[model samples]
Target chain A: MDFSLTDDQRMMQESLSRTLAEASSLDRVRKFAADPADRGADVWAALTDFGLPGIVIGEEYGGLGLTLLDAALMAEALGRAVTPVPYLGAVLAPLALRLAGSVEQQARWLPKLASGQVTAAVAISEAVAGARDGAGLMASDGKLSGKALFVADGHAADLLIVADTGGVLHLVDGTANGLGREIMTGIDLTRRMAELTFDKVAAEPLTGDAGALARLRDAGWVLLAADTLGACDVMIEKAVAYAKERKQFGRVIGSFQAVKHLCAEMAAELEPCRSLVWYAGYAFDAAPQESSLVAAHAKAHLSEVSRFIARTATEVHGGMGITDLLGLHFWFKRVGLNRQLLGGPERVRALAAQMQGLTG
Target chain B: MDLRLSPDMEAFRDQVRGFLGQHKDRYASGAGAERPREAAMEWQALLIDNGYAARTIPKAYGGYGAEPDILKSRIIAEEFTAAGAPRGFANQGISMLVPTLLEVGSEEQKIRWISPTLRGETVWCQGYSEPGAGSDLANLQTKGVEDGEDFLISGQKIWTSTAAQADMIFCLVRTEPQAPKHDGISYILFPMTTPGIEVRPLKTMTGSAEFNEVFFTDVRVPQSAVVGGRGRGWFVANATLKHERGMLGDPNATEARFAALIDLMKSETVDGQRLIDNPVMADRLMQLQARVMTMKFNGLRTLTASITGEAAGLAGMVVKLQGCELNHQIAALAIDALGELGVLYEDGPHLRAKGGWQRNYMFDLGLIIGGGTAQIQKNIISERGLGMPREPKLAVA
Candidate 1:
């Protein structure tokens, strides 16, 4: 089994690492956050220029058809930059369509998604008053009526792919008459989310089954996990770099065991989160049967680990970490939001348990 | 990029699996010994011999393929454990002595040493930590005076595992005491049967004497016995410790413990429900299970990086640290699974897991302290892995 990234994947990582560091630096993130819509266009254009917008879309649909592993690697870079783009939504919506959408539907949407002609949002979330699982929604008579909370990048999406209680995916125009999209005040300023309330919105049902929908859900989990993994990498890097330079008690604070251990613990914890993310992304593409299992494992485990790393990293920066001056909160908050996105540790563990036949 | 094995590797795994399948007799006795201790040793030998062609020399040896592929190493480990091989080949002779010899020993020494150790014929114990030097091992007071073509050594080494059973001891001694503590040392190998050498077993808190304190009162050895140069023992000893860290407290040990815990929980019931059916217990198991899975992937990632000539990054430093922590948690969870019965050390109806939890809970204490304490691990991770500056030394009063 090859666990190393392919050469192209490495190139994608390096390219994005360089591009994001320059284009979406902390200052850039703050600027983008001021007007998320403007940020969305700029981020989308850069990603499209790098051909990342279509990284996962099939070549036949004027896209790259790269594995989710590659896109997930890019997602990590996005996370590192806290880049304000609807990557999870844009990539996953196309992925859902690829896995479940009809030929006509994919033909219409995949190309635009690849070329940045349109943005998409994934509505796999449940209502605020319901279970975190997407089973809270139901579509009746080709008109969808349910609340999809935490709809990522919902405000910027030209299209929305919403899932129902039966695991059927329904495509709806973002500007549909009955669709109500409310922007969410999320913890991470670097990204955006929304609550989409569907009131008998005209929906085009995708030709997919429960199984396909599960794969799509797992793909989302893997992608989100990759994002957190990226954020974690950045947190430790920032923490270590800060520790080395920040002096106190007549020596660099890194020389102090207390601060040293914090950075060390974070490094050790994140090392595993990375491996989990890679496998989760790879499993989605190469090992479909075990995709959900690894995805659940990655999402749940990274969610827990990334949070620890984030906080410990912030702790490493001392008072400066919690302050807006260092802006380390961008990554810390990004990790916090990623942990709760899709589902948190306990919920994902339950999904993993079902996969293992340990619980019904 | 992928985790699926190639057809060739799969075929190799199938062959290994077949050999393991044939010998399904359990090794570790739970109050009842299923196989002789000799049989268990032989089973380990069989595993080493059986996976010979599949075994790749470690990356340190510049041999990378087939076996050094972490997946292959893991598969071999899986089959060996499935066949009930020992938790690990914790033999200092193989894990530490052989690697050190291969790195710095003379051609004659390697030819004379590595094979016999791998065959379990010549047991060896490390003689690095002395009574005066525990964590700051460089300060060891063990000294060897030059005596034409040999060295007369007189000092004591403590916390030596398997010294009583060892045929030979790989030691560090101060050959040039006037030099700096680190530079004045030498790595030497000598037979445990040498006159004036003594081994006293030290019973640990676990109620077992798996560790020993060894004394060398003017023990003599030929000059050829020194592996690394006389003034370079510190660096050589570091190499052995690196090897030691890689083997001791491996995640595989915890994985085995986890599997055993699950089996016990399956066989056990409380109020007509399986112990694992309890929400609190199940959630804890799931968490441990997730940690174990992450460890597995981390191992693969490290292996993949090693084979690809990429710096393994923090994954290398993570294994032993996380392994000790994970095992402690796993052991704790096992005790939690037993509830009030966990306090029972010996056999009884309420003594779930055949009282293994109590035994493990104590045994695990030594593991976390043995190779390096958790604090020491964190220090290494911080200093080496995170590039943190070393902590200032305290002044001796």
Candidate 2:
């Protein structure tokens, strides 16, 4: 069977990687983290030019009708560079909509999203942890209430793909009446999070079934898994290179067996993390039945593995791994933020076990 | 890029699966097909008869001549592994020697060896690790001195799996003593029945004599027996190792083993609660399943890398290590979760699932040690995969 990437997809990945490497390197990420409000409009426009936002939108929506795999490639690149764009919120949210959204909803919002003119965030997480079934948010009488905490790119978005108590998806304007936002200080600075308070705000349903909210949550989890996989790679590479260059005990610390073992563990964990992302990505694109389990596995594994890599990487760098000068912490923060985002490793692991039919 | 398989390939996978389904009753057995080598040999011959052996070999070399598709190969491996096929027996011959031959064997070599090896007419074992050269394989002292048309070899090789059963061997010997450690090595192929060869089986924790200590007292083989160039055996061996590690991605095989363990846990109660229902056991099984799935996915990523010809050095060194570690973990978890019943062997009256988990727990040490020690894999990734500096070798005065 042919598992190879098409030439266009390969070039897309290469150009995207090159752009991120040149314009939004770890150094650039560190700079952006210092000023989160300073959006990368030029870079975002470059991404639009690169068709990053339009890769998955249908041609009828003024975008390329690319598969989920294409979006995955871009997500991975963004993850590796720790690029501070709401690409996931902007791209993945729409892609999920196209997959599970209503026909009219697709007709209404797809073009604006495909043109990169609007950014959106999916509000699935509630005020408290482990609230799986639209825990705190309630939607009734064409009015939405309750709050969604840690709404990614919440403050910067033009729209919110809101999931209510009944699990229907609603496309709500960011400035809907009674909606308030409290910018939350998070471990990751490049990506902003906010506590969104919806005080009976006007809402519109995007998906009729509440079950689609689960799909949205699952898709979002897998995307984060993809992103964490990328961040893990960045941290691993940075730590390894740093170890090779930084000297201690009259020799490169890398030459020491202890350091060797440490980096090897990272490599070990990183490899599996990569595989999980791919399988989850493949499942997301191809197999629906296995996607939830695979996604949970990828997310849980990446959550733990990326954090382990970051921790080990920082240790390998000694004092410098923690500092902004090294820029390794950016990846570390990204991994941490991703880990805590939808459901932490504990939640995902529990879900994975249930999916595997191993629940007690 | 199209990650989807072509329709023909999909049909081919189905054909392979259909064939496996028809013949799975024959291959179904426990993991302990390690020694008494006849069972493995017979199984290998059956695979050859069915054209399921040496799957990656091209048609001219007595293989299916299928295109290099890692996913297809992965599916075949997973199906066969699920059927409890003897995977260890094929490790050296199918996984290592056959692939290396495809990469570097001469036309004469391919015609002479590849077909027979794939046909199971010639069983093979690897002779790489020695007592003193476990992780540092290049430090092996096995030497072959040239004498006219042949090379006289005299050395000792330890930890050679299937040595007693192997009819042929693909070994590395020191051909240039004065050269650097890596440079002096040569990969050689020879009949195990050659003069001066002795295979002494060594019993392990599994209570099986599966491995051997082979000694060669001036063994002679023709110059043409070398797989690649002389003094380049290190590279050939490395190539073989790479192939061996790549094919080790079927993590779902553990599913069956875990199934067997769960069955035992169902019948046997622990603390008045079913063992499978225990929170600790449940948590451990769940974690193991997650890790297994993670490893499976990692394998897919590496397969993608292999299919695309991207660099997979990191992928190879890491996934297998993780697999081995997970295997060990699952085995231990099975034992602990079994309570007192976990310690019994197959023949015991209190035997549970044929004492498979106990045997597997003991046998898994070899998996970590055979291809490369977990420590060595870590070192490789740290140094090569991660661009870390190499660890200094102990000074040889």
Candidate 3:
């Protein structure tokens, strides 16, 4: 028995890592983050050329028909580069549709979603914090009447799949009547978030069973966890690199055991995340029974570990770590945001406990 | 990649399971650590008879000579570990000496030592750490002066665990005192009963006399006693360290410890509420649980690389450092969860989980320090694992 990635998967990983390393490096990410309207169009175009958005879409829908794990790899690279792209909303929203959308809905939307012709945003949170069990938006007669706060890439979407108070989904067009958006300024400017208000906006209802919303939530957790994994990877790598080059008291910082131990401790905490996110993503596709528990585990554990790594990584950079010049804060802020995105450690572990039957 | 074993491997697993199912009750009475040498050897012989002992040894050496299939080996480890049957002697013989011998021993040495060691006829211990040379092992002062057809060795080795039980000690002695430190050391072997040898048992901080200070007052061994060539002790010792690293933290055993933790949380109560029901406790447990799974997958990745003949490189070092830390954390977490009972030892009936948590906490300290200290591990990782610049050596004068 082997748990290593397939050759194809490894090739995909290497190619994406190389491209992001080249095109969406932190310098480029800073350039994009400075432009309020910029969502890394050049890097997005490169990824579109690589057909990343469609990696998990069905073959019949003009996509690669790979698994959620394949898409999670892209998420990791994007997170590592801190690239400004609406991957979860634009790429993964299609999978949500494919999971719960009607046959005609799939026939019409899947190809367009896979081809990058249409972009979608996911509106799953209502408060500054996340909505519980996908229950927040209220819907009646194919019209969404409540708010979906913190909508990812909400302002740029051509379509939006909205989760409501009953943990059901409602699909709305971007140009639909009576819909308004107040763009929110988040610490992580690379990825955009907005407060979307649906004033009886016209939307089409999808098949929104409890199982469907749970899968969407699980997918959300896995994607965010994968992104955090990526952030931790780069933060540790960058910190270690800085330790070797930066000097203090006539010795390189790494020569000091304190700095060396800090770097080593970061590795110890972050290395486990590689496999945690991997198996979580794998469970999303191949082992459905293991998906939720592992996803919760990944999210909760990485939420805390990535935060520690982020703070320690910044500390490794010393005083310059907090400044905008070195751009180390990009990774630090990315991890900070990802730590609280869907559910932080406390919330996620509560869900995990319920799943394990440890709590009533 | 798929985690399903092939049918052949599956059948092999079943064979091991069925065999253990039949004989599990015999010799399962003794804890593996407490099993006497003869009883342990008898169990080892039974397992050897069933083609499980010396799993990687060649069939020419009365072993099954199984191919280097990682899963089958894991299966043997899992079953033998579960059935309470001793896998190998609780000493340095199986894990360290056997592997190093296969790599560099003479064919005669193999014939004379390999089978008997596998059959548990000989118990081996290591004599590497001395009182003054614990972490800086290369600075050992043990000397071996060449005599007529023999080397007269005079040295004292400290903290030699299992020395009382070991039939032979695989040790290092400085053969050329005037040469550079690492260059003068040589790996040698001799029986514990040799003249001028003395073993004084020392109780460890954990309150066990599991270690000793072994002194040799001009003990003699023939020139052929060196395992590898003379003045190659450091290199051979590193080889043994590799095997020790691989064997130190078995992830499956960590998984079992976690399971026991969950069981304790399920049964134990704090302030009339079950421990698992506490949010802080549950969160901590969940985090450690995730780390355990990651450790398992990392292990699988290592196994896959070995099976597919890829260069695992410093992956072994990564596993060693991370594995020990994980084991240590798991033990520490258990002790923390035990609350008041954490203060007690395993001798008391009132202690939680029979005070296994405290006992394991003591054991994890050895794992962290043995093979190499955590600081030494970081040195290796920074120098070799990450290609960072090595620390500049100070003037030795």
Candidate 4:
């Protein structure tokens, strides 16, 4: 009946957090956010050195062979630092391949993806779920066309795992002919997004069934929820620290009920999310039947709660919150972007209702 | 992160199921009927005898006296809730006062109070809040002047639930006027029939008098009635209040209510479409579903912390705040889903769920404010959990 992280999981999270703290300080994050040429090469290298990219990859494929729960913890660490890195795709691409890719395909790419020798981007949002702005991808006659928007870490990827209009996942080469990548500048500079234009570009389809796609979506939701949980934690911490030190009316602002309540509300809202995300991650591997529904719950709930924390934390910082010096907006924007990524709360709830047979 | 129970626990669950299967019908006949006091006492005694209730208290105290096992306790609760079996006695006496007495009461007090409380023979009501000491309870002015072996009590206690039916009252009184507010209090227990004690029902917005205001004018209790110690009542009361908060924020109750809500949504319709099929209502239901899941999982995490002896900290502190608010919201949403039928109470010919949702919506609001106001909870979370500074003391006038 144990429902807590194992000691090893805790140690792993602590180690990753320490590495991220040293590698992606606020100054480094700010500098990386401002520089167009910087692709967070250093931060990615630190994560790779820490074996994070391979945490969930198969041990047979030059990786640690950990579970999704471990990867979610790593995502949380990256979120706390708002580290400028390509982690979403690094984890999700391998997961999609592992879940649906052919044996030969897994043998070819798993080792490279696991060792950080190659970087991959995932483009599932437009075609599989939450399609918006007339954006989608289609595959026919061994060729891919149309556009996939909001491709996480698309710019520097050597490989792309994309879902087509029929919900079939395919592997595409980054430098394939007629494949065009246009970077979309989102408010959250910590992670980059791109719109990939596919004009009859060649793509090899994965052989798995629709269940694999659903699993990928569930994994994506859990990871995103974990990331939001991490970001909210940092925002609350920053707000509480600022309140303790910042003074108004001849005393520290934390002594005031209003400021204290703001911090308290944020904590109250976010503390539950930690367990929620952990349970979702645990369900991903240990409780397969409930995986999809729990994932949706985690995603939808955190999407709403993180927004509150982000806003309230920013308000706690007073005018300094808006200033670039505090870099509070990084977390705030990160939370904002997370709410809409991979489907917002409304769509996620709709999916949950449908899953429960509550809606047609 | 395994959630599966052990084989031993599973066997224990089956044992519980079998026990309930055999004995539940004894009390099932009285469901929805007015209080069947004798039958309830018999059922409580059966539970205590079977280790289904008072499982952790000592044998001398007339409990089952099993070793403390959180998982077994959880299993008992789940099985009882599932089978609709009577879960023995659960009142302020058993839930809050019994635990406090076990922790700090004298052997005489334990032998005298714990056994009867567990057996449903003794009903108790809390006497912490007064009109002046609702949130800032240390400011209580209920004086207990020492006179020989007894303390002469005089004060008013407000919002005392079950005061009318309670046979005993555990109270807080100011025993020392010159001492600091937090240090001048005493926790005393006495029979509700004590001379000069008055209980007047205070009708709530729910249109029922489940709570009351009790006046104590020269009500006398022996010095032995003071549990924990005389000037340490504040600390003892805090301990009991912790249990009170836990009781009010029970995830099991919320889960059951949520399940009932789903049933209502599925059974009720508007404009020839089921309410569950309505997109707006479905979305709202899913939102509540998320919160319900949060409460359940967070509860599991806290239980794990307890079993492992780890500090739950903020996770434990936020339960009452989140649970109470979420329960209120759930009831509010249920009413919204009820549509035109929502306004119908027990008297209406077309009343829904026997007007339970309407009653709960109003009662849950009281819950949020009663154990600790949401504002006070926030203060505690910020001050203790987050290590935020306390509000500075204002200069005394």
Candidate 5:
């Protein structure tokens, strides 16, 4: 009857957090964000050393074989540092493969993906859910065509797992003959997105049914929620630290009830979200019957609450919050992008309503 | 991360279900309606005797005397709530004062107070908040001047719920005039019917007089009535306040209310369509569902932390603030779903759910303010939980 992280889970988070703190500092993140070619190679190497990319890959495939909860923890650490590395893809690609891939397919890519020899990105927008600009992909006759937009960490991947219009997942080589990839400048530079065009590119369909795709979507929601939780935590800490040192009217602004309440409100609203994300992640593994609904709830609720925390935490900083030099915008924009990445709060809530049989 | 109950705990749940099944008719008759006091007391005593209530208190104090097991306690609460059975008495006496007595009371005080409170033989009202000392409770000027072996208490306490019906009151009073505000106080207990005591019912927005303005004018009680010693009332009251906050923000109550809201949405119709079927209403319901689920999981996390002896920190601190606000939002949404029917009060012919939603909407507002205003809770969360600087003290003129 426990609903908390195991000691080993806590240690894993701490180790990853320590590694990110050293390897993905704000300067390093800025450097990566500013450079079009860097692609956070150094940060990815750090994560590889920490064995993060394979946290959820099957042990038989030369990977760690951990649960979605472990992967969610890694996502949280990445979000906390706002590290400019390709983690969302690193986690989700393996998850989709494991959930839907054939044994042969798993054996082919799992080891490379685990060892960071190959990086993968997922293109599910307009497939399992709606995309902002009606972006989509189509598959036929062992070939993929059409465009997939908002592909997270897509520009520099060695492999691409694209979901078709019918919610079928297909694996495509990044360097396929007819494939084209273009970077899409997004608000969050910590994690990049891309637009992929597939023109008769050869692809292999995952053997499993749509249930795997749905499970993969649920995992995505939980991971996004976990990431939002970590981002909110850092934003609140940054705001509190700033308020403690920033003086106004002859005293630390933190001593003012207004500033204190702002910090307090952020903490209050975000604290419970930790449990929500944890439960959603736990449900993904242990309570499959409830996973989809809980994941939707976590995603929608955190999307709303994280916006409040982000905006309010920034407001707590007054003018410095808007300045690029303060770098609060990194977290601010990270949360902004997370809010809309898979599905914003409204879309997610609508899906949850449908799942509950409340919508026609 | 495991949420599965152990086989032993599962067996215990079956035992509870079996017991409730046998006595189901005894309490089920008045499931949602208010029961007669005598019948309620009988039901409470049966529960205490069966180790369902007061499960951890010693038998000498007329309790079940079981070891404290959080999972078992949660199981009992869940089964009892599910069965529509009254899970013994809950009030200022039982939830707040009893725990304080168990922690810091004299043996005599415990023996005299714990059993009756547990058995619903006595009801208590808290006398802590004053007109000038609400958020600043330490500024209370309720004086208890010593006269021989008794103290003559004089003060006014507002927002005292159930004061008009209470058998006794656990009160805070300043006993040392020269000492600092927080250090000069004492916590004392006395009969509500003591001399010079007056209770004026304070009708709230819910159109009921559940609370009162309790006036203590030269009320005399033995000095021995003081619990946890003199000059320690602040600390004792703080302990009881913790219990009070917990009582007000019960996740079980919120869950039950949310369930009722869903039922109402299903049953009520607008424009000949079920409220639950409306797109806008459904969206709102799902949003609230998300928050409600958060409260449930957060409660589990807190319970796990308690069992594992880990510091819950901010998670524990935000419950009252979040729970109260979420409950109020649920009730508000219920009323909104009712449409024009929402405006109907208890006396209205078309009133739905016996005006429960309306009453809850108003009553939950009082709850947000009563235990501690949302602002005070935010202060506590920020200052204590987040290590933010405290609000600076104002200079004396």
Candidate 6:
């Protein structure tokens, strides 16, 4: 019943906050941007060594088995830094696998994911071309063929969790026969993306049915929401601080009513997003049955708000903000990426409305 | 951080609900009646006698002295409002004036006022707004000159709600006119029945004389009646207004109104379709429902912060403005729900649903203007909440 974070959780927040603050420094992110392959290995190991990927993984799988709140705290830290790590691909992908994969699949992947030895991506989207009235790709006969657009960190991942029209998850090797991966140029360069082509890719079925895959996708959306919430938190702090430090009309610009109002609005927008994300996290932790609705609520709310806060953060920073003089842009891009990632705001909202019986 | 109530609190809620249920029909008629003050007072006394009143009042005073876990009291307040009991009018006296007195008044003041206030012995009305001092309240010209051991007050107050029924008035008077606009003031408590004091009723659009124009002509009150230090009236008024902004706009009123609207929509039909089944009405309801949810969340965040001793400095302004705006929107929405009857204020052949929509629509107009103008709240949001610069004031007259 307690809404307050525990001391352990607070420490987790602080530790993550500090780690990202230093590691995701403007210099660090700039260096990574300059050499994309020089990826955030140090930060990655530090987070994993701290048992981040295993946050929701059961202890039986050599993981911490903490709640999504813990996962959220970790995501918030990543968001604060706009750090370049495939946490969604690294953590959520494996968590999804553990949730929906068969015993044999879990045995093959869970330990590697827990130990940070491998990364994975979930492929669910398909291009809407040559479509019928109710067009969707079928996943019968085990072999897989279809292109999953905007596969996050697809090129870097070791495994791929693919879902088809049957709502079932098919686990396939990243470089399996008939599987193709193409890196795409994206606006938020801090986050990489890939187009995954599966030409009847060799695959192994996971779990008994696709029902678990649906659950996993919803959980993934919540995590994506958690990630965006984290990014928004960072943007608010950055904008507020910038407002205080940057001056206009012979006073600190933060002293101006317009800037103050903007920051306040951002703070307002961020708090609810945080609360919604936490509620989703709590639901995931306590009530698995209601997770989908909460996740939709969180994702829909966070996507719009995080995007707003990011834009406001940049606008509040003025010209200095445009060049990445401060570390603000990193968090800004992270939020922008999150808004479009895992389905845009409109899609998420439509899904949420449907879930609420509003669409029906 | 937990928003959930304890078992004890839940039990307390049930007990309160049961008591309210028992007496619901007895006090159902009045919307804002003035004469039968005793009916309301007697209800307060009953609540106090049964330990159901002043849930947050300190025990040292005549209250149960419960440590204020305000959410519980808020829940109780909501139940009372939902039950349509005018018995909760003493809320301002208990929730606002009493707390102010406790904070700034002497021990003697608390002894003299807090207990009886809960018992509904002393009704209070706020006297901060003046004809020329609506949003710019500090420019108030109500004067209280020092005369021997007392202050001779001569001034006028506008938009004073419930003044006709009030036993006393908490006023913001100009004490040091030569000082700066904000610094030259004092917060005083004066009896409304005293000599040279007048309360002229101002009829509202709702057909009720709920507000007033009060005049004070050399009304002498002892210096002991000042709630806080002289020339500190601005701070005192701000504190009281802060309480109003933070706690006054209970979601209970709107929530009850919304629930009723939904029920009516369900039972009624337009063009042979249930009102709730119509997309236009359903979408509107969904949006309002979303707003209500956000307001609830905002209340929780503010309440949690207050409990943790980190008050949200200007977010209160945002809450107040949102409450008023949403209330007005909901009223309009209700009118749309009422269809043709919305235009009729009386029970006529053309009227429907007892003409409640027209009454509500008119009543909501006063809500935004009375507590603080919506524009003033926006100013607060800009200057204080947003740290925006104050607009240059016109030269003082």
Clashing pairs in 2: A5-B1, A6-B1, A167-A210, A275-B297, A275-B298
Candidate ranking under DockQ, highest first, comes to 4, 5, 3, 1, 2, 6
Write down the TM-score for model 1.
Answer: 0.92
Each model's number of backbone clashes? 0, 5, 2, 0, 0, 12
lDDT over C-alpha atoms for residue B178 of model 6: 93
lDDT of each model, Cα atoms only? 0.79, 0.76, 0.79, 0.89, 0.88, 0.72
lDDT of 2 at A171: 77
True contacts kept of 3: 0.60
The lDDT of model 1 is: 0.79
Tens digits of per-residue lDDT for model 6 on B1-397?
Answer: 3446789878888987898888765553222535336666676656655555766677677777676776666667767766766544445666579878877888998888888777766777889899999878899999999999999999999988879888888899998989999999999987889999988999877787778999999999988888789899899878877677655455666677777777777777778887766666765665565455556555665666676777655444567666766777787887887677567877677776677777767776777766776666655665665555564445969
Q: How big is the positional error of residue B40 in model 1, measured in Å on the Cα after superposition?
A: 5.9
lDDT tens digits by residue: candidate 1, A131-233 = 5444356689999987887888887789898877776888998889888877888888777888878788899998765566687778888888889888888
At residue A229, give the lDDT of candidate 6: 77
Per-prediction fnat: 0.76, 0.74, 0.60, 0.93, 0.89, 0.21
Q: Which ranking of candidates, highest lDDT first?
A: 4, 5, 3, 1, 2, 6
> lDDT tens string, model 2, B66-148?
55566766666766665555542354676688878888989998888888776556778889989899877889999999999
Q: Interface Cα RMSD for candidate 1? A: 1.5
Ranking by TM-score: 4, 5, 3, 1, 6, 2
Q: Distance (Å) between predicted and true CA of B132, model 4?
A: 1.0
Q: Residues B1-397, candidate 1, lDDT per residue (tens digit)?
A: 7667789888878987776566567343211111125664565555555553215544332222233556667777776666664533446676677778878888788778776666556678789888889888899999899999999999999988878777889999999989988899999999999999988988976677867899889998887898877789999988878878887557677778888888867767779898888877877888888888888788877777876788887788888888877888888887877777777876666666567777778877777777888788999888888778899988978
User: How high is the lDDT of residue A153 in model 3?
Assistant: 83
Give a tens-digit lDDT track for model 5, residues B1-397: 9999999999999999999999977782212212227777888778888998888989998899999998999999999888877777777788899999999999999999999888777888899999999988999998999999999999999988888778899999999889999999999999999999999999988888867899989999999999999999999989878888877778889889888888888888888899998878888999999988999999999999989888888999999999999999999999899878987885667978888888989988988987889999999998899898888788988
* Runs in model 3 lying further than 4 Å from the true structure: A21-25, A126-135, B27-39, B60-62, B81-90, B346-349
Docking outcome class, model 2: acceptable
List the lowest-lDDT window of 10 residues for candidate 6 chain B.
B27-36
C-alpha TM-scores of all predictions: 0.92, 0.85, 0.95, 0.98, 0.97, 0.85
The C-alpha interface RMSD of every prediction is: 1.5, 2.8, 1.8, 0.6, 0.8, 4.2
lDDT of 2 by residue, A143-205 (tens): 888878788888878888876766667778887889898778788888888778888899877
